[model samples]
Structure formats: structure tokens, C-alpha cells
Target: MTTSKKRKREIDDTQRVSFALSDQPVTQLGPVLAHFPSIKPTKSTSFKCYKTQTQKPMIDNEDMPFAEIPMLVAGETEAVDFYSSEETRRGSLGSRYFVGVHNKRTGITTLRAAPLHILTHEVKALKGLQPAAVSTLQRLEARAALGETFGTKKAKLAIRAQERNKVDISAMEGVADHLQESILKNTSTLPSKEEAKASADSTRLIPQYDIDALNSSDIYPLHNMIPKPEWKALSISAYMSAGGGAERVALLPFKRSNWINDHLAIAFASPSPNKTAIKMLIYISTMIAFHKATFKDINKEVIQQKLPMVPSVVIDGLLSRFTETARGSIEARRTPEKGTMLLTHMFALCLHVDDFATDTSVLAADLSMEPAKVNMLFKTLGCKVNKLTQSDLKRLGLPDSAGEVKRAILKTPLEFPKPRTRRRA
Candidate 1:
């Protein structure tokens, strides 16, 4: 009671330590101790503790790596674990253990590996296992016994080398005799070359109308003047059969107007008014042949004047009839071979009758083909296709300042170039 307590020592506010305050936690710190490098913990310091509640058990009851897991019924327990706790394994054995789910309503087990399982409920027992009502076991046994003897019999019936080597002269003789008889019959039935030629000549319809009497006005004179009997007998197929130069000449009249009038009349006429309209258009084409205008140009003019329209298919078919199609080209436009021949014949006829050559442009326009292609066709026909010189223009009665014009002139005893041959290496 008598000892006096020393007064508690008090530190000054100026000498006390202070800390900075923040609302958010500090995520990063500057490299203050980075230069001192890190040291890994030893085995003693990094020891694992199984006693801890945070540590997982050796075998974890985790979900398997599957899109869906089989759900158990309310009262039912899950299936027993497929893997042992002692075994150091990863992933799952659920796929192997749970083959499939059984549908109670359908009574069908829908399996994951159905293809591998291959359920054969439809396959019946072998005949040996269960004999048919009609076939008794004794009969089956007898058949089985006969199989060996049948195989042996087949083997014995097979021809040996010696027997196979022997020639059957009688059979060969019979075959030869049959062949000889057939040959004799064929030869007897066949007509002689001269007889065949005579028959062909008789079948061919000779031009009945006088060529001298024909004029430009007579567009399809051969078909128009000839009777149906003779007209039908004028075989285009026979003319085309010769092909090459002869075919070109024979088919010239067909390209003019005869072919369409004769054959295509039925095609156009089936649809009534088209026939008359198409024929009028063709007549107009013939009338305006000297104008150097294309069929398309004519069509355009007709359309502008509110005339009957021709179908594109009909026009295409007409073009195909008078043109040779180009092979192996992106632009499948046809070459105006038949058309050029037709023009050539018309030009030659004009030269014979009117005593003058025709212009290439006029021929091209008449055929509704390019003038360049028409000129090429003329050259192929052994004609001289040349640009109009001043003299040529003057002879043709064109003005001195007339633009470039190409003319095709026929020469006597014309020599044609050999056809080009494609070479493959």
C-alpha cells in the first residue's frame, strides 16, 4: 500500500508506425524479392495429410466422362463399382459394365453396341438339328450318303486329256456343211452390183422440172412442181449417203427452201397458224435475199412491225439443218458449210443466167451466218474469195469510194486442199 506505482510509459505520436488503408485487395506486388530467386519445399515440408477433410479418398465417387449417366430409380441403389479401390486407374469402367438400358414398356434392350452384338432371333436351327415333316431323318441320312458317290460319278464322267485331245471330224464336217449351205443361200439371195446400181437408179427421182425454167421466184420449185409420188421418192438420205462434194451439191436445193417446205411443214402445221406464218416469213426471206440481212434481223424487223413471232427452237433447228456444228469448241456455233454451198450454187446459177458474181456479205446474210465463216467455206470449195479492188468495185458497178467488199468467184477444174489430220504424240 505504501509502494508507489511508476507511471506507465507513453510513446509519442510522431515515433509510432502507420499502415496505408485500401478498399480493394492487392492482386499483384512489384518484384521486390524476385532477384532473390525461389526455393522449392523439401519432402518433409511438402508432406500430404490423409487426415485432412479437404483431401479426396483413393477412389472418388465422381461422375464418369459420358454425355449422360444412367439415373437410378427412387428406392434402387446404384450398380456396384466396376473398378477396385487398390488399382491405380483413371477415367471409367461404366461404359463396359452398363451395356444398355432395358425399356420396360417395349421389353427391348436398346444397346450402344448393337452392330457388334448382332442378335439373330430370326435364324432357324440347322436341318441336321431338326428335320422337316416331309423329309424324314432316314431320307436326309440317305441323301448325305449319296453325296460322296455323286461327286465320284462326276469325277469319272469328266473327260481325260487323251479323250479331249481327239478331234471330232463328223461334228466339224456337219458345221462346215451348215456354213456352206448358209453361204450359198446368202449368195443366191444377194443382188449383183450392177442389179443393185440399176435398182438404186430406178428408185432415185430424177429432176422432172427443167433447170433452165427455174427462177429466183420459184423458191422450192422441185417440191412445188413435182407430184407427191415423185417428191416423196426424192430421197435426201440417198443424196447424203455419198457425203463430201457430191452431197454438198445434191443438198444445195434442200438448204434453199425445199427441205423445210417438204419435211418441216408437218412440224410447223400441227400447230395450225404457225405453218402459214413460218412459210410467209421464209417467202419474205427469199424476197429480201439481195438485201444482205440475217434471219435474226428479219425476225427483229417482223417483231417491230407486230408480225407473228417464230419460236427460238424452230430457228435453232433451221440453223442446225443448214449448218455444220463445230467440234471441241467452247462456242458451239455451227459452220455455214451447207449454207455456203447453197449460196455458191445460187451464185453460179446467177453467173450462168445473169452473168455476175455474188458478194460474200449477201451470202452470209442470207444464211444468217458470219461473213468470215462463209468466206472460209467458199475457200474450202476451191473458190477465189478476194477483197474488192477498185476495178472489182467498178466492174460490179459500185462507186469509187465504196467500202471494202469481198466477192467469191468460181474457177474451172478447181483443186481442193487435203483435209487436215489431227496428230497425237
Candidate 2:
């Protein structure tokens, strides 16, 4: 035989062997298939099928791994429906297939999943309707967006009609004439010249301290001679209403029966007498009596001493709970209406020294306030301003020739001015 014919015969024999191996079972031809690129050996030897049965037969109860299967059913087969024909026949659709429904009562448009036939019916109905003008469409859209209904528009129109039909009494000429007549009647009822003069005379007879009507200087001088540390400590204590201790007695001399002796003892203590302390004590006492003190009244002393003032935050806190600004002036005094126990106790010294009828001049001298201003404060407290005449001076053991001097006499059953009532027209 020729060499070419021999090579062709060898190639045909190899092809026949491969074709024979491909026809055998995978398990039997495992090693032979592994050598071929087209056939791969799987890692697992478990049985598998690409085409699976849709319906599964229920397994026997004895074949189940768990003996006590609570909800097991044996010998029953389940058939699966792939096309969902039941849902289609029932006219139920998913959320993606929805239609907008407008509620006339609520004036709200809501989307709901609807069947295909209902959607087709709505489309046909809309097609049969006449096209709206641009202006009319815009107006309807605006009303829908604003949730304005026909009933609401009707209510608004009814209100406008009512307003138009109503008469305005203030605009009528007869009403104006009636108002003019009333004004003339009111003017006629006013007091006559003689009655006015008598009223003025009666008013003069009553002693009234007209502080607002006075043309006095607002400036009140202050002299601070107290040591910085001592004054600061004392101010903080007074502001806080602190009473140190029971044993550290006689802090306020005014409270004791022997107040004069106590005052002298405190004024002339061991190391050195604090003359400035006495002045401050008296000033604080006056402030407590009136329940008011001004920053302008103490600003000069504070500036002169070069002491650090209390923080505005602390002052604001104090104002909220304990104090309020005095009326009539922005630079007015702050009246510590609440938490005045310590201050009142301190002020007892002044009352004791003044024999309950405080002398305005003496208080003014200590507080560096005008005598008239001090007098006004006393008058506000319902104290009677009496002139110490020759007879009065003699009775009080003073020289008769000292001349008449004014003094505020504090009396029991005090009479205060009645608050004026406002008349309504």
C-alpha cells in the first residue's frame, strides 16, 4: 500500500473511536469525555433534568423526614397555572394599570387600579365630549388645584350680596347729626366757671405730692466711700437677700429697740469706723422703704469707686423675679417689689432712727437725693406733711425760734388717693 493511503486509514479509525465514545452513557465514558474539549465531567454525580414537571404529586406521610408534620396532606397533587387567567377573568389589575377618579364632595382626584374594559369605556366617553376653550380649561384647572367647589363659590357670592344690602350707620348723614347733638349735650353737662373754681379750691386744700408735674432735675448725686471688696460683698449680699447667721448679730441696727446704741457701735467698731458704710446703709434703707432705686442715683458713686458693676445677665434675672422698672422714665428706678425681706429689715433702722415719722432731709442727706424728691416719696406712702410750728417745736423739745419746718408724719389708718375710673362712651 502507498504511504498517503495508510495515513488516511489511521485518521478514519480515530474518528470512529470518538463517535463511539460520544454514544455511550456519561458515567461509562467519564475519563474519555474529560480528554475532549466538548464534553466536561461534572463535580457532582446527582441526577438532574432541564425539563421539570409543573405539577408535583404529594409525598406519602411515611416518606417525610419529620414524623409529626402538623399541616401535611398525603396523596394530593397541585396543578400550577402559569398565565394567571383567574385574575384576568375577575377584572382585577395591578397598580400600574390605574385610572384617576374625581370626588365631587371632597374635590380630590384619587388614582385606582381599574380593568382594561372600564379604561376603554372612559376613553370613549372623553372622546365624545366637546373640547373646552383654553381660558375655560385654565380656570377649571386652577379651581381644581385650589380645591374650590361650586358650593363654596355660591357661599362667597351670597356673603357679598349680604354686605351690599347692609347699611353703614357711620356713613349716614342722620347718624352724623345725632352724634353732633350728643356732643353738644355732653358739653352742656360740663361744670360751670364757679363750680370749676370751687373744685380747684377743694383740690388745693388736699395735700398732694405731684411728682410728675414738678420741674426738678433728674440728677441725684452719690458719694461712695466704702472699700471696693467690702462694698461689692455687701451689694451682692443685699441683692441676694442673705442674712449671714444668727450669732453674727446686729448686722442691721434698725431692728433693735436700742437701735441708736447699735448704730453707734456699728459706726465706731474696733479697727476703724466705716463712715461710708453708714451712708450706704442709710441709702439702702431708703431704697427698701420706697421699694425702688435708680442706676443713675448710684452711677456716679460706682464710676468713682472704679468697681466692677454687676453683670447685665444677673440684673435681668433679678428683674424677672424680684424687680421691675419704675414708670414715667427710661432712666427710672427699679422697684424690688418681691424679695424685700432683707431690705425691709435693714430699712427698719431708718424708721427707728426717725421715730416712724421719717425726716426727708435726713434721708436725702444720706442718699444724696433732693429733699423735695424725698418728701414726694413719703407723701406717696400716705404720710402727712406737717409744719413744725413754734408750739410743735416746743412740744418736741426744740427751740421755738427755729422757725417752721416741714416733716412727714406717718399715721395709722392711712388714707390713699382713690384710683381714677375711666368712662366709656
Report the CA-based lDDT of candidate 2 relative to the real structure. Answer: 0.39
* Number of the top-ranking candidate, with TM-score as the measure: 2
- Positional deviation of 283 in candidate 1, in angstroms? 11
Q: Each model's C-alpha lDDT?
A: 0.38, 0.39
Where is model 1 poorest over a 10-residue stretch in terms of lDDT?
28-37
lDDT of 1 by residue, 1-425 (tens): 58768987798655554433322222221111001012222323221111112243443223322212221111111321111121111222342322355555444554332111111111123323644333233454465456546646654344343246656565465566677668867999899977875565333222122223334323223333223443233333333343444343333332453323333333333534333333333323332232233323333334323312223333343334434435664332323444443454333333322113446675455556698876765554445766657766776566766436556654444433344679998
Candidate 1 residue 247 Cα shift, in angstroms, is 38
Candidate 1: stretches off by over 4 Å: 1-344, 350-356, 390-397, 422-425
TM per model? 0.22, 0.26
Q: Model 2 over residues 77-182: C-alpha lDDT tens digits? A: 1221111122232343332243455555554555433222111112223445867433433454465545435447776576566557756544565656666668
| Candidate 1: residue pairs that collide | none
